[model samples]
Target: APLMEIDPRSPVPKYAQLREILLDWIEESRLGVDDAVPSERELGLTYGLSRMTVRQTLDQLVDEGKLYRVPGKGTFVARPKIEMSLRLASFTEDMRARGFEPGSQDLARRVAPASGHLARVLGVAPGDPIHHLERLRTADGEPMAVERSNIPLALAPELDRHSLAGRSLYRLLEQEYNLLLDSGEQTIEAGLCDATDAKHLGLTAGSAVLLLQRRSYANGTCVELAISTYRADRYQLHSTLDARR
Candidate 1:
């Protein structure tokens, strides 16, 4: 429907009508990734709307990750996001299933004292030894997420002896230490990338991001506390739902 016209008398707001029109254009391949969107003035004139309404529609699409703005330039269509299923799986496994080669870059690895919050989550006492591992996870050599993992040092004393770059931490814990993670609890939220993480993820500071906090359990004991930050432009979480009477 490249020539689909908005019905001004159909009781729908002009901004919403224009929004749907633009979405249809993108879906129909009339607009492609990196293709510039019409200027606010031009869109308003075409859709019989005020410039403010057109700007509002554009802002909504931008926030939803369908468009991006370039300074001193105009807005353009963005790349489609990757849908990530919510399940108990390692990043390596997930990427492989999606046909993307997964890899990691070790940022920091050391034995450190457990913080009060982390100690409680891992069921360890404060000041206890903990293995802290930070890495930049990648897919097809593209930066995907920044992950920081904490494991009680007493549970994996020899963890430092193994190289984790380009490997799955969960696999190592299961195969080498026999600490299989049978279950986990995870919470996700929207956030803005910070300067430190943005640098590693190839994004500017304050970009939209997804913050994931997970606690993995082995034999009913919490074994891992991981906090990961994923680029919102590249990832969207999915879950299946069941209806009941």
Candidate 2:
């Protein structure tokens, strides 16, 4: 349908009709990543819409990650979001499975005394030594997430000696240390990216992000506590629902 086909007599509001038209264009590949969207004035004139309505439609699209704005340039289509399944897999494995080259930049790795909260989470005594590892996770050389992990030193006493660059921690524990990672529990929530994390992710402070906290188990023992912050604009979580569950 043409951009000027918005119907005034139909039950749908003008703004919604315009929104659907734009979405159709995107979904049908009429608009592609980095493709400049029609200017607000152009769209308004073509569709006989007010500037307010056109701007509102564009703003909603931007918030939905269908479009992005450049400071001096106009709005453009955004890259397609990566749909991530809520599966118990390492970031390295997940990205590789998705056809993206996975890489990690070790930001911090040190032995630290477990705090009260960390003690309970990692099944360690308070003040016990634990390995704290922070890394910048990347996909295809693009910053994707920030992962902070805590592992009880008792589980992997020589963890520090291992080379972790672009390696899967889960795989290292399984292959190098002969530990079987059988299960995990993960909780996810929406949050604003902190300045420190945002800088690592190449996003402005307070940008939307997905916070995932996971506890991985080996032989029924909690082995690692990891908190990951993912760029919301580039990733989305997917899950399958079953009535039996």
Candidate 3:
């Protein structure tokens, strides 16, 4: 069925009415990825709304990742986000399972002291050895996320001996170190890309992003602390809900 016409006489706010109408346009393919949305002035005129109201509606959708704003290029329809299922799986494995080729580019790798927050999260003492690994992870040659991971080096000594470039960290832990991943806890939040992340992800500074902080465990012992920033326009999180009586 066609979407209901925006009711100017109804009790519902005009901004909401316009927001839903535009969303329907996106779903119906009247607008597609990279397609520019109407200018605030044009939309305001079309809907008989003030520019402030039009801007407000657009801003909300931009924050929701339904639209993206380019510095001088105006707002455009965003690409569909890739749904990341809530499960304990490495990026390489997850991509492969989804039929996408996974790859990584090592940005930096070094050894550092696990102090403060890092020490607390990994259950290690202050000044304990930690491996700081940063990489730009990709699927099908498209950059997806930048992961900065810190590992307690005492638990996996000589971890720096192996080359992790474009390789799965979990696979290395299991196949070489004999450490099996048992569980992980993660949280997701909406954020804006910083200069560093924006440059790596091919987005402008302040573009929408999904920030993930995760702790992975091996046999109930803390093993890794990872902070990953994903392009919000191209990534999403999905979870299944159990129906209750």
Candidate 4:
């Protein structure tokens, strides 16, 4: 079905009415994430409004995270956010559980000496060998998070030999190194994208994002400390608390 036309006589202002109609189209698939949104002039003309009105409508949507604009390119509909459970799970497993195809692109990976904070987090001696891996994780071909994980090399010796290009780090630890993800302490926070993160996660610099830091334990020992950044518009954390035991 076509979207409802703007009602000139409605109590709502014309810009607000147009904004709602466009948002409804985005929600109902009348306007997909593809580059099909009409030009500002075109949209104004279509709705019998001025270009300023259309611009304001788009600007509001952009701020609300309903849309994103490219510097020289036009704006496009923002992808729907993926609400995920707060339970500990590998990125790959989480995405798969949500019926999305999970993928990872390794940005940087190597074994390095664990320094002050890294050593403390991994519960290892300073200067101990540590496996550092950085990768951009995606769900259904859309970038989701950039995970930077640091693990003590003593726990997973020769781990660098394996090709983790598309594999789950947790799965690899379990199967190859006998490291179990027994428990984890994770925290949630908010931040704006930095230059590096913006490039990897496909967001403009300073875009609002969700920040997560996790310290995972295996067999009563710290196994890894990972920091993950997710697009605020593409991920929502979900958790439940109950007294039943």
Candidate 5:
């Protein structure tokens, strides 16, 4: 079905009207994941609205992670969301428990000095040598999240030799490095995907994403600080809170 016309005289904003129509189409399966959305000019012409209005509407949808755009190509629909639990476990372990095949594409692996933020999290002095690993994690070949982790070089020197791509980082830490992660703290917040993130996550620039910052510890020593951004539409963090009787 084609997009519905926006009543020019209505009080509802034109951009908002477009948003609702697009959402309805998606909900009704008129538009499926990876479907090519109409261009701004086409949509504007069809709705009798200005091109600026259409651009604003499409931009908002992209920001909400409802759409994705490829450079030199057209905008497309995003993939369905994947639920992520708040339980403490390795990425591979968590995915396995959820019946999803976990894999990763290592983006970068190098030894660098800890930044100010990383130094605080890892309890290392700023400028101290640290091993950095950047990866795009996936489940059954579908992109899930982009993760960047920093570890003190003194603790995991052999980390550079391991093949992290398509493997579990936590499992490698335990079996190969003889380290056990006892506990960790995490913070979650909403964030917009930048150009680099959008490219890796297959989203439009400025798309809404969930940012997670975590610090893992072993024997009361902070061992790693990881920053991850998960696609908002593909992930929801769930927890069950209880009241003491």
Candidate 6:
């Protein structure tokens, strides 16, 4: 344990000052996740503070979900939460804007016939050839989401050759093929992750995840169908709803 000094003349209360010091230590990785912290009595003696003050600080941290306490054991640092923004933006752009080193792992890519549901969504005949691409998206070396996309084969035949793992699909469509994405409609739902999804997303099986289905159109023609799953704990969907006139 390093020497911790509390400024008696500081404007902040003693308990809050102690809590901030502990939090800074955790954030700086001086105290790692699940690492046991000093007990209230020990911390009090070390800082020359009352046991009640140390306990108060610890209790506040626990309430804020930054620490966990066990009856017989002691308090331990909690894992940090990943923050996600709810906005209308491309995944590639979003990851880059956040200063995260983003990359994608291509799972599969093949030209296959569209099924009934896919055909209906794409406004094409059943069994029409469509290009399917599946990828796992990562940010800052962490698994973020799994994206599966379907595109009309005739529209973007060279999509299979392009390396999509580290770039934006939307940019590829516009830059490589001169296709313009006019607009898109998206739907969101909550569901538990399946085995393959869990493995790729680095989440425990049956953990809650957000399922997003989107159909994008270009030049008044249906162009893409995308299905994505995002970790629920690290994401929240946001939209502004306006009342009807």
CA-only RMSD, every prediction:
2.0, 1.5, 3.2, 3.4, 5.1, 6.9
Please, what are the lDDT tens digits per residue for candidate 1 over residues 1-245?
33978797989888899999999999999999999999998998887889999999999999899999998799999988888758889999999999899999999999989889889899999999999899999999999999999999989888999999888999999998899999999999999999999999999999999999999999998899999999999999776778976
lDDT of 2 by residue, 25-106 (tens): 8988999889999999999998999989999999999999989999789999999899976878888888999999999999
- The weakest ten consecutive residues by lDDT in model 4 span 29-38
lDDT of all predictions: 0.93, 0.91, 0.89, 0.88, 0.87, 0.85
Off by over 4 Å in 2: 1-4
Clashing pairs in 4: none
lDDT string, candidate 6, 1-245, tens digits: 66568988989899998998898788778899999999888888877789989989998988666887877988998766555555446787788897878788899999999999999999999999999989898888788899999999888977889888677888998898777888788888999999999999977799889899888888888889999998875666555799999
Q: Measure candidate 5: CA RMSD.
A: 5.1
What are the runs in model 3 whose C-alpha is more than 4 Å off?
A: 1-4, 38-56, 71-74, 189-194, 203-208, 243-245
Model 2 clash tally, residue pairs: 0
Q: Give the backbone clash total of model 3.
A: 0
* Pick by TM-score: 2 or 4, better one: 2
TM-score of 1: 0.90
TM of each candidate vs. truth = 0.90, 0.96, 0.79, 0.80, 0.70, 0.68
On lDDT, the candidate that comes out on top is 1
Q: How many collisions per candidate?
A: 0, 0, 0, 0, 2, 1
User: How would you encode candidate 3's per-residue C-alpha lDDT over 44-90 as one tens digit per residue?
Assistant: 87778899989989999998888988888899998878898579899
Model 5 lowest lDDT segment of ten = 79-88
